[model samples]
Target chain A: MTREPDSHYSSGNEAVIGWDIGGANLKAVRLSREGLQVVQQPFAVWQRRDELAEALARIAAELGPAPCAAVTITAELSDAFRTKRDGITFILDALQSALPETELKIFGLDGKFHHPAKAYQQPMLVAAANWLATALLVARDLADCLLVDIGSTTTDITPIGGGKVLAEGRNDPERLVRGELLYTGASRTPICALVQRVPLWGGWCPVAAELFATTQDAHLLLGHLPAEQCASPSADGRPATPEYALERLARVVCADTELLSQAEVQAIAQYIANEQIHQIAGAMTQVLSRVKVVGPVAAVGAGAFLAEAAAARLGLDYLRPATLARGAASVAAPAVAVALLLNEEACV
Target chain B: MTREPDSHYSSGNEAVIGWDIGGANLKAVRLSREGLQVVQQPFAVWQRRDELAEALARIAAELGPAPCAAVTITAELSDAFRTKRDGITFILDALQSALPETELKIFGLDGKFHHPAKAYQQPMLVAAANWLATALLVARDLADCLLVDIGSTTTDITPIGGGKVLAEGRNDPERLVRGELLYTGASRTPICALVQRVPLWGGWCPVAAELFATTQDAHLLLGHLPAEQCASPSADGRPATPEYALERLARVVCADTELLSQAEVQAIAQYIANEQIHQIAGAMTQVLSRVKVVGPVAAVGAGAFLAEAAAARLGLDYLRPATLARGAASVAAPAVAVALLLNEEACV
Candidate 1:
């Protein structure tokens, strides 16, 4: 991973799509001369690699027409490709193929944008480096603060100080060792993984070892997440309603309405949520242990609730990324951040 | 919830298929006057209600031909039907349509064999009654013992004494309360649901909430399960290899090989397995709290290892049904048990 000087951080004017693509899903933000739009879509790349171009076309269609695009991807780590180089080459080829003759640029680990040919040459600089875009953007707003972005399937934690990215590890594996990354998230997590035992009939009972319930169920039951925000193809392939969530959570302990009361299931959901908060907090603590918080912690991504809870537990101030990007935009912060950066580059 | 006496347990002679139909899968055993055969197949009844008839026919064909059939069902609990009665009627109709003029007898909760007419009149008695068939067959060998049958997605623990089923809870709700049943299993169960945090590099980390891995992975890594023993639609839809398992289990802690070593993931798997056993043991202890174990515990089902571990933890003698049925036959103990009973009745 390389760090670059900001001498080229100038301004130009045009529309740009800041794309943050990952193994299981895709997120993007379109910033035109008119305005900006942030979007997130689920795309199981490993299951169907061919449809990715179609998905991008659809997302772009939703964002309206654009002649310029900048991309940062984590999807390269997916087993669909043989190596990081293969993944980056494939992604670049996808962009070149889908938007021929369009001005396409890739975000590099060195903090600059590159044409596809150049980006492909240093694949390591472009492999799964989207988080840096968000961190770099956050550094512009606040110095000496921790950033937590929890998506549906994973969480990214990074530290920035003195208007600079200070992450010890710029790569996924390094971030994990330093506690700046965790795989847990707000949704899609099976509840059984959060805790072994749950309160049942006045005693703690072990949860079932099935995909009967997920973090989405817990969040839905607790009223922290809206129905529309729930992941489709839910844990049970049923609607992510509180009722269905109750059914799902009950299965964690191997029960149904016939066997467990709604109240008992509710208790189990609460227990899971608490354990999840603690899990996130543990990672956050590991990252923030050395540095004392002087200001609010930035909470971005779909699972901001977990970050908020972790910050509270640590007695650190918590700031929602939505305060700057707003609802859907915050959910797709990295994409939006890149879009903003690209727009700035265009303005010059 | 009813128990039948031996007066109706007469002998006859014919080939019989003992069918245990569940909401998501089917387990069947064909018992001829001479020998026995056990089989299992996945059938998501809810997703394809109309295909139930075809599924049964296919399963029967796999077992060759049968002159008579004794059926025990749990598929009624599936939402495919509005009520247990509807599920029973649907299943019976499917059986009749698939096997015209074939002698069909349904196992009622009362422990008596009922003609379709009688079984249809009160569907509740015939719903999810396979457990009784297994317990009754076990009673023939050890009247005073606990039957722990761990399947792919559930575990059934029943108490038998004095040559009769002594479970206080006849229905699912009652059974859940008495710790006589658990939804945890050995293969299909998601590993995340088994534990909140797994032991890792000198510490504990929350397992990935995704379907990144399953108990099958732990067992695979530990060498207790063969690759062939893995479920077809694996927890992550990947090959059931130790290497892939490492990738899956590492995700539990949100790490990849980059951040974690192979040794670390192996530890995580071992930790998950231990926690899963403890979970089963906890439930087992709750159920046996009020009883004195005078004989060996009957350990059956796909997850019998978990039950066996729990039994060893509790200092009880654990008996593998394979000792009585052997190999795959033990995996389908309930199916085999009912088939044996059906063959005896067919002889009479």
Candidate 2:
């Protein structure tokens, strides 16, 4: 892997922070002119929305004092349409309330920061920034690359060309319904809504209304989702455990087995694993159809199953960031790519 | 085929009307002493809730002057918890308002009609009536059977025992989440939420967010959902067509293959078909697991593909009712079975 150029510590003390607010977990990293440094303590915003402000305050306290902070928020608080704007507003408001002294910049699709100097309303820019960061950090040769960031509630498949992220779709509901927003995500996705049928030993089986298992359980069983990730919060703030995952999965389809026999549950888990892999692969193919990329695809997400499955299915080389970066780098490729682009543009 | 007893239709005025309010279609059968005359009109209520009430009013006007009517509301319109009682009340009020002079009795799961004379609610009475009608007029010798009804938004799988419908699972959302409600249906089901991956030529593929197609299109292409069924009124009162079905199906997965080659579109259609068949088969297996039945499975719905796929996968005999009476007959079988038991108990 090519190492990033030595950090050029700018005179400005302003720092940029990227936050990935998912349905199950909240991840944030702090980056300065020096580079990314873990804030030491990360905030956990699970089911309790009321605690969000407090959590951000705690995170802010750990970050000490900074001149300015950039925040990007994405979560599965509700259906796509219901939560998108509100979720962003909530996070921004909370951050502003918590760190009142810092120069707060809320990032949208626009690459420009939402601050006093630059009034940027472009959502694609922020999306591109995230995408760019991911590409630069992971795929150094960002040109002709497709960056897929699969999260809990949705997936973002972006094409990179000429060292710039291409934004073909909107991240909103109407666009989401129109194929702009990839709906299939890793956590909290209803299984019944996934595969219509699960092939059994003798015949096919249909899922019941009950939540039998979630993709989390399937990934856990396959050892794709690690214990650390599993222990994170669910869509609601509740701690996500193997038991919770199993209980949710068990409810996917109603069966007599209250606590499914290990074999039976495993069968469902395997089915989900196969389906998830299939979905990720299908998305990769779609991205490939649009852009002619020279190198292997790059994936950045907490969902290891998604990345691994896509890599294996496409028979392409894949890379995961060695260590999580602060700010946007938590998402890897996009964060790094965005940072690189910003740095180059600044130099020019 | 067993003939109905002469006494079954001896009374010229003894007739009962069965109304099934499904998410996609509204089916009404007037079983008078003169025989069953079925009037089936399809309507889409996904976006238009008022149209549902108007459609029911029109049906009531057409069935005017009937002594009594048994209406079953099965759709997303009525939440079991909040609107179960209110839903029944609304339907009865509508029916009463339409048929001012006729005596209309609303049917509830409790088995007893809500009338001034009844002190206790006999929930199983409706099941008994449905069972009696089926056994008396349709399946005479079939003792144990599974009734699968695939509607627009949901599927109902009822098990029959000793001529009575087994009442074990709750038909509402609570029980639905527990196993009673299977949310997968034939049409209008969002596709993006279905499978994680699609099968490409050699490997699996992930689905994009574009509205591609739905199970409705799959069934239509596969010749399972009939042209007549496909012609149901959309929410806008426009007649549905093959192109519309394709559009709807594509919308499920957020795929718009109108620009795609026929071969490519066909492949996507096939993938949807595979998922739908799998879903139906899975649900069928769930019902089969709970009850030990010897006879073939009986399916009645607009989704012929689901029934055929389920039957073929399970190696069970599949029976389709010739007319709309199939639903009434299916429900009647268990009703009759229980009635027989009640009769035997009374005699003892």
Candidate 3:
């Protein structure tokens, strides 16, 4: 579950660990003089919230306890807490527990870093702010570029120009309206949310609005994601095997294996995948039209292929975050960015 | 508090009590040869789910317990239960405890009544199915009509033609996509849901997507609902008074009375109300266009005003359910419908 440090990892000196704690996953990056050491764990926080401190301890152990920690979180949006404030406080408390002696800085929505006390005061800023860190890092590399970070449950499309994050939205709803934020993501999104109708045998059929299948199922069937990670059904509470995924997708159209063959299911997945791409492409177009700079789009996240497809569809130049940085750092860009920012500030 | 029944002089010879158990309110009707006697109590089931048996017992005591009881429920959709099945079983258990000796007939979505065990077998049919009973009752009287039943949290639009219920959707999601169901309701629906844009001094401004005010506030500000009833903050979590409602509504637009006068706030409320009507009116138009029979629209539920306005907009005859039946029965049509059905079935 943990990727140990490579040979290039610097000694404990000038070392910083970054954390992107989400509802379903805990990702960490340790940035040293040599390179980025990343660790990812599939932790459904809601199910085992009490074990958060323990999970953090495990990730921290992987990084070998860096001098300072830079943490950003979206897990506060989960229902484990009554309010965002509670989620933020709980997450911060866990971070404090994970690194009791180390200096910790939390990334805020205002594009600044804050101490735990200050971050706790403005819980909204500290909550779900990993996107800002990634955008900030991307802005550093390419002053004029579009940052497309699509994860499991959401998408962040930020315009970076003149070494500044040109974002019209500060909060989730505002971002959603301004096309800087999209609720649709590559994985965990229910297939019903992608399209109203699906192309069946020869005609278009209206889809059943049930949680029978998700975008993960579509992407899995299409071989976009590794079969092992194709569909981690933390919420679906079902086996995440391809056979089970087939059954789940078939049920979406009110069919079963007996009625629908694998080819038919694959066709459904393709139609769904195409619609999802169109969704992101539409949002990308909106943001692209509003901006004055003709910058290339930077595709990032576990769902980076979506951004690549979207940029290609728009006939815009595409830049991979992995090309700009290491694959682990690119996939876990926010964590790496925050860690770099912290390291640079400490050196200053 | 349970409202005691008046002495309309119906001894127990042919009396039958019908129940409509919603998540927030419990409405009951005692039907006899004289008339339909209704009693209502505000019982928040989610707050104290275990007290459901006790709450039902109190309500049944108000009606003095008839020999036969017919029940329809929408509370199964509440979050008190793990699933609709669990909710149905819990509700059935509560009803059994409340009326242990009474011959019970539970209304099912299949347009028929079933015994407790039979109804439990088909939990989905028993869940949020009070509307079907009312629609079926209305269908018997007026074969061709569009039924608009709006409650505190949701609305149901059913098409009745050829003396049968004609619906494009059966469940909530299906009904939602088919336009037969709308999550927007009279009392508890957040104002932000009604309209995205609201009238400012001269221009339309997007309202803050916050739960500052609900539809109850708009209705209260317009003087449609009485002040006593207007201030029912059971679910709204704020004082429902005109003065308080004004403050709450002002918050929706991120304004205050000093900055945006009472007239402006009133306009906002009016704008929201108009948009809500337009929403239902639009749905009515969609359903009306598909049906061949040109029938009068039956307006029921507390939000019947919206239906009346919708009927006026469509230039169709508006028939008040209250006029067709008792005043209380019309207001709580599902309970009345079930009571009538129970009374008829008792004779058989």
TM-score of each: 0.84, 0.53, 0.71
Candidate 2 chain B: worst 10 consecutive residues by lDDT? B339-348
- Candidate with maximal DockQ: 1
- The number of the candidate with the highest TM-score is 1
> After aligning candidate 1 to the native by TM-score, how far in Å is the CA of B86 from where it should be?
6.5
**Order of models, best TM-score first:** 1, 3, 2
TM-score of chain B of each: 0.89, 0.72, 0.91
Estimate candidate 3's alpha-carbon lDDT, on a 0 to 1 scale: 0.73
Docking class of 1: acceptable
Residue lDDT tens for model 2, B48-116: 556666777787667544555555454323222122233334444545555565554434455444441
Overall lDDT per candidate, in order of appearance: 0.74, 0.49, 0.73
Task: Tell me the tens digit of each residue's lDDT in model 3 across B234-315.
Answer: 2235466787677677655544443457998899889888887887888777666676556888888877877888889878
DockQ of 2: 0.07
lDDT, residue B30, candidate 1 = 72
User: DockQ of every model listed?
Assistant: 0.29, 0.07, 0.07
Lowest lDDT block of 10, candidate 3 chain B: B2-11
Candidate 1: tens digits of C-alpha lDDT, residues A50-76: 888888877777766667788888887
